[model samples]
Each structure stands twice: as C-alpha cells, then as structure tokens.
Target chain A: MHEEPLVRWDWIGRNWPNIQVLLEDHVVMSLVPIVVGLLVALPLGLACVRWRWLYQPTVGVMNVVYSLPSLAVFIVLIPVTGLATRTTVMIPLTFYAMAVLIPAVVDGLTAVPDHVRQSAVAMGFTPLRRLLRVELPIAVPVVLAGLRVAAVSSISLVSVGALVGRGGLGYLFIDGWQRQFYTPIIVGIVLVVLLAAVADMLLVLAQRLLTPWSRARGSA
Target chain B: MVAGEGVGVNWLIDFFGDPANWSGPDGIPVRLLEHLQFSALSLLLAVLIALPLGLWIGHTGKGALFAVLSANAARALPTLGLLVLIVLLMGVGTDIPVLIPLVALAVPPILVNTYEGIRGVDPELRDAAYGMGLRGGQVLGRVLVPVALPLILLGLRIAAIQVVSTATVAAYVGLGGLGRFIIDGLATKDFPRTIGGAVLVALLALAVQLGFTFIQRLVVSPGVSERQAVR
Candidate 1:
C-alpha cells in the first residue's frame, strides 16, 4: 500500500493537456461566481446601511441559506434550473458568496469611522463621491478580507459541482474515486489547495496595495 | 385530472410515504443514525484533542499563530477531496477514511475557539485568581474555563454543524450515511430520493445549529452571556 508514489510523473507527462483543462475549468468555475456575487452583494450591503431594519432580518434569512449544506443547494436547484449547465453551479455559489460577503461588506462599510465620513462631507463630497472615494477606500481591507473568504469557499465548492457532472477539479475527484486512481485524487487536492492559497495570497497582496494606510496603522 | 407529475412533489411524497424506506438496512433512520454516528464521533475526538491544546496555548498566551493558521487551512480544504484522499490512502473497506476527514474538518473550529476563548480571559481575573492562592490548574479551571465557555461553545456549535452537514460525504465512499440517497439517487436517475436526501441533510444541519444555539443560551453564564451579547 505504501509502495506507490503519491504522484505519477508518467501520467502527467502523458496527460498534461487534460490536467491543464481541469485546472483551467476549476479556476474559471471558481472565479465567475465570485465576480457575480460581488456585484450583487455591494449594492445589497449598501442598502442595508441605508435601511437599518433591513439588516437583521436579511442577514437572518441569508444565514439560513448559508447553513444549508452546499450539496443540498446544488441538488435542490436541479428542480428549478435543470442540470449539467454552468448555471446550476453558478446560481448556488453566487448565493453562498453573497451570504458571506454581504455581511462583510456591511460590516466593512459600517466600520468606516464617522469622522472619516464627516471629513469627506466637510470637503464637499457628495453622497456618491463619499461612498466611492472615502468610505470604500477605507473599507477596502475589511471588504477584501470578506472577498478572500468568499473566493476560497467558492473554489472549494466548485468541486461539489462534480455531483452533477459539472465540477471542475471536482471531476477529478469523482472520476478518480470511480476508477480508483490515486494520482488524480492527489493531483486534484494539491491543485485545489494551491489554487486556494494562491488566490488568498493575491487577495492579501491586493489588500496591502489598496490600503497602504491599513498597513501603516497596523505597524504603529 | 392528471394523477401524477414529473420528478417533483408526488415523487417526494411517495418517497417519504413508503414504510419500507423507513425500516430497512438502507432506510432513512438507519442512514440518519450512520450520519449522526460519524458526526458525533468525529466531534468527540476533535474536542478531546483541541480543547486541551487550545486551553494550554491560551493559558500560556502562546500559539495564536498556530490557531489562526490551522483555522484558515481547514476552511480551505475541500471536504469531498479530503474524504476521498484519506479513503484512497487508507485503502477503504472501513469507516476510518470518513472519520479521519470529519475529525480534520471538526478540529480547527474547536481548537481556534478554545485558544481564543482562553486567551480572551481578562488579565485581571488571572491575577486575581493567583492572588487568591490558586495554582495554575485551579486558575484555569475555576476562572478561565467559565469565562471562556461562551466562545468554546460557539466553536463546538460551528464544528458540530459542519461535521453534521459534511458527514453526508461518507455515502460517496460506499459507506452508508445520509448522503447515500443523493449519490445513489442521482446515479440511478431517482430524482425524488435525491431531493429527499438533500432536504434531510439540510434539516439536520439547521436543527443542529438551533440545538447548539439553545444549549449556548442555557449553559453560558448570564454575566458572560450578557457581555457576549453586547459584543
């Protein structure tokens, strides 16, 4: 049982194209939902701040949605959306992202100090200008933190798409299990973890670049 | 009037209505028991390992980095991938693979929570405990643990819900758990069973979450609980 090497170089040598395709598919599947989710969550999060009462009830509902098992969400969607299309995975994952990211966005925006908002107003900034320039810039660290989480989770979930034969790296898992192939299973894990790590690292780097003040504040 | 419809409500009703579906080797109750068994055992093992390590680190004010790193790493792991990898490594035919991944999934929350909870204990309390002639162990037990109970319980709740939900993956590895319905149903084009399984798993997760919340309210000290609520 221990004799077999964990990764098979020969298989990779023969099948680099297939591996590349799976990797690309995985990245694409993971990223598309994050992008879409951000677009939705930003506006919704802003609205939450605008209407205070909407915050608690909406978060409560989203929490329930978030707690629903990811697989169940995928399966239950088949009735409404049908199967095997990219939308099947995209819809549920986008919701999951919003569930996490909305609160993050809200918290991030709310965390922006009142003095910062006052200074922006004192400088004659309009509501739109204030949100875009002052509030958002300051909230970048927290929002990006939320984005990092959403991205990592979405990447992990893309594999669950394999249940419907639509998973990216997930395909490798289901197929490897059926064929009893150790190489693909190990490869898939390495690639997924590496992808998650790389994605997280890039987000962290983005946070640093976008909010140099945060780094300064932290060090002080 | 049409008596039936395609793969929707009627199928779900019929799936649940069948008495055979509730009492057999592969019945709902048995699968639920299997799912709960995996979750409960994994949780027990995780708490045993994480609680003490977390408490020690928290008490000594060390290993904060380890706590954060472990929690982040655990979250990034794809539960399905981990389950399959362990099964492949262990060479199947038993429940070890499933249990291993479930425990792995459960540990970080409890570990991080316990560490953070213990660390969050007010320094004054620790000094007071010492001033009153308490030893290290007594200070931890009498003062720290009570104060840390809320966060520790929060961690347990997170781990328990997670294990309960993800335990369904066990069905994929030819072991019988609640996931069997979804995997087997999909394989055989049995959409009703698939939907039923999904619903059951979701309900179980929600129930566990609610149960933990209730337990948290009942057990956490009122003073500490109020502080938590204010936060």
Candidate 2:
C-alpha cells in the first residue's frame, strides 16, 4: 500500500528562491569539472595518441583513480584543502572528469579513419593543424558523449561533498534524511534528475551545433 | 610538519602500527571485515539479479531498450541520495537501507556489460551452435558465456571496486565499516585517523582492482585473450 503524498508542491513554491540557489550551486559544481577536465585531458589525450606507448599506462592510472570513492577523496583533502572549500570538491571532481574524458578523447581520435588521417596529412596540413582542423572536429561527438557521463557523475558525486557542509541539491537529501521528512529528499531527487537531463540535452545540442556536417552526411 | 596538524606518512604508519587498533570490536580488522561483508553481499546480490537478467535480454534481443534505459537511469541516481532516501522510508537500524542503494549502484555495469558482451557474440557462431541442435540454454551457457567472459569479468571488476568504494557511505547510516574512521575521526577532529581510514579504503579498492585483473587473466578464454594481447 502507498503512503501519504511525498511531493509537497506548496512547500516547494514557498522555498522557491532557496531551491533556485541550490540548483545554481549544483549546475556550477557540475559544469566546472567538465570545463577543467576538457582543458587538461585534451592535451594529455593527444599526447597519448601521439606517443602510442603512453595510452595504456594513462588509462590504467585513470582506472585506478576513477575507483577511488568521491567521499573519501573529499574527506582525505580536509586537512590539506580544508573542509567546505570548493577546491576540495573541485580538485577530485576534476581528476574524475579527466579519468573518464581522456579515454573518450583517445577513442574518439583513434576512431577517425586512418585513410582520413593520411589524406589530411597529404593536404599540407601540419600535425597540429590536422588535429585541430580535421581530427578534433570529427572526435567531437564521441568526446561530448563521454563528457555527458563525466558531467552527470560529477553532479551526483558533488552531492556527497554535502557531508562536509555545502554542496548543491545534496544538502536537501541530507536534511531530509536527518529529519525523516520526505519532501526535501523527493524534491532533491527530482531536481537532480532534471538537472542531469537538462545538462545532457545541452551537450547534445552543442554537439549538433558544432558538427553540422554530421547531420548532412547522415542525411546523404 | 606540526605534531597535531599534519597527517604525514608517519601518522598513517603510527595509526596502523598501534596494537590496540587491531583487536577489539572497533578495531581496524573488525571494521575492515564489516566493510568487506557489506561490499561482498552487495556485489553478490547485484550479480544474482543483473547477470541472469542481462543474459536473458542479451540472448533474446528483446527488451534491449530497457537495458540501455536502466543503465542510464542507474548512472544518474546519486548513491548517497538513494541511500538516505531509502533509510528515511525504511526506518534505518538495518543494513537493508544501505544494501539496497549499493546494489542499485552495482547493477548497471554488470547488466550493461553482460548484455553487450552476449550481444556482441558473432551471429554466425550463434547460428552454428543452434544449428548443431543445441538447445537455447545450451547455446547460451556454452557459446555465449565463454565468448562474453572477458567483458563480463570486466563488468564485475568495475562493479566490485565501485561497491567497495561506495560502501563507505554505509557509515552515514550509523553502520560499521572502514568509513567509521573517516566519519568518527572527522567528528572528533582526529586528523591521523581520518587520513588513515581514507588511505586504507583507497588501498582496499586498489587491491580489489588488482585481484580482479588477475582473475580476469586467469578466466578469460586464451583464444580471446590472444587477440587482446595482439591489439
């Protein structure tokens, strides 16, 4: 049998502004890792692809790093980075983003057909120029797909940082659990899922906008 | 470098070196066992549910959409959030609240990988096995399972380490695990204990990773593994 209604709309309407702030915090924490991860991973992933020997080791290290729990990473940094600091969450989050993104970047670049790469080289495109003008653009969709996973997981893990004090929508879950109230927990789950969906959609949109040729080739 | 402020390697060594910390109800060994118990049970339950479901779906090719959707949905669900939410509903004091979420967290990889691995089997091989008058179950157990073994093991590795790491969240529910050190240390402001716990948990995860990698090598089909080696 079902229990009382968990969705408290009137309560949500009353606390709209506070909810808005939490949502903003969630988005900020989530997006920062994606941007930082891409900046760091792009070059590292390129180097791995270029060097060939570096790929396995890089991925192996990333897997190990990826396996570390987010909460532990946050708590472990408290003495060094201090609790409630964005750096504590951001640094570990960035590492996680890199762990997922680097492999995605490598896969995307490698997925580019070898003949296509050779033709780009034969066209007088310098190595850097080819990567920028040809390979990277082709790799965009794959990289963005990986970005979605990194982004969504970061958004979820950032909630764990709430245990230290401040993190976005996660505080609601903590508060609700402590008080045994369902509203905040329900609201947090709903809003967090909505945020992930919206973020995923935005990335999809960005991929489409950036790669118009993909659509054209698809139709042809 | 300060006596009480910095949690150095010496601090970890000293924390671990203490004999008192290894033998009681609250000792490191006890907590480590508790953590392993929680993680192992969660992994076992997850495998029980996901493996068969994944195999069935992969074998049938029906409900493939459900597998994708569930994997994505599971990924998006925050583990901590789910744990707390379930606790609130179940009225905690039992491990069920904690185990439920951990199981939820563990399932997606196992299910997705098993499904994908089985589906990726060469259609011709599948057809040949069926043509040989083998029953559906026989084809799946003999042909699909062997071919899909590497990916399934990979999935298990990912799931096992993940469950081990995330099981630390069990401490939040007032359950005993290695996370007690981190949580209790933070509450009492014991920097050494906190850092020591975090290090231990990391090491445990790394050990699990190593153990799984070794198992994967031993269990993977040598023919399939040869191809991976060449690649």
**Per-candidate TM vs. native?**
0.93, 0.94
Off by over 4 Å in 2: A1-5, B1-5, B8-14, B229-231
What would the per-residue lDDT of candidate 1 be over residues B149-192, giving only the tens digit for each residue?
A: 98898899879978876777667887678899999999999888
Would candidate 2 be rated incorrect, acceptable, medium or high by CAPRI criteria? medium
**Please, what is the whole-model Cα lDDT of each candidate in the order they appear?**
0.86, 0.86
Tens-place lDDT digits, model 2, residues A22-65:
88888888889889999999999999999999999899899889
lDDT of 2: 0.86
Off by over 4 Å in 1: A217-220, B1-7, B128-133
Fraction of the reference Cα-Cα interface contacts (below 8 Å) that each candidate reproduces:
0.59, 0.57
Best by TM-score: 2
lDDT for A200 in candidate 1 is 98
